[model samples]
Target: MNQSSTPQVPFWAHLLCGWPLFLVAVGGAVGGGLGGLAYGISISIFKTNVPMPVKIIAPVFIGMAAVVLYFVIAVAIFTAIQ
Candidate 1:
């Protein structure tokens, strides 16, 4: 077997960077999922019982709130862990 002449990267560097990056990625995914879930719930809740303006506006606000909440929570958790 012939060995390539390219330099090898250190494992510690990969570990140090990889874990946090992985966590951040997972956090973002979870956050987006939770936001979508909140949007769905908000849609169900606002479908028939609210005023037209409220029906149009409340879910958007709710989804935004959910996304912000998720982002904050995820960052907090990631920071805490690291």
Candidate 2:
């Protein structure tokens, strides 16, 4: 096989500097928003009386991390399965 002269870019580099960031950002936003709302609702239902801002923010951060970080992994798994 003939090797190409051009160097290949790393996945991390692409993630940081290329199109993947967009996917991550979108995923993070959507996930974070829904997570926040869900958390707030659950808390209200439980009647724990936690502050709304705190409850929402904490879950938002977690949800953002979950969806944002998983986008790439999901794609990798999909490719591997194929």
Among these predicted structures, which one has the highest TM-score? 1
- Candidate 1: C-alpha lDDT: 0.55
Write candidate 2's Cα lDDT for 50-80 as tens digits: 5646644544454455455466566876799
User: Which pairs clash inside model 2?
Assistant: none
Candidate 1 per-residue lDDT, tens place, 1-82, comes to 9886643434542332222232234456775466556655654555355565775566566656665777688789889999
**Candidate that would win on lDDT:** 1
Off by over 4 Å in 1: 1-29
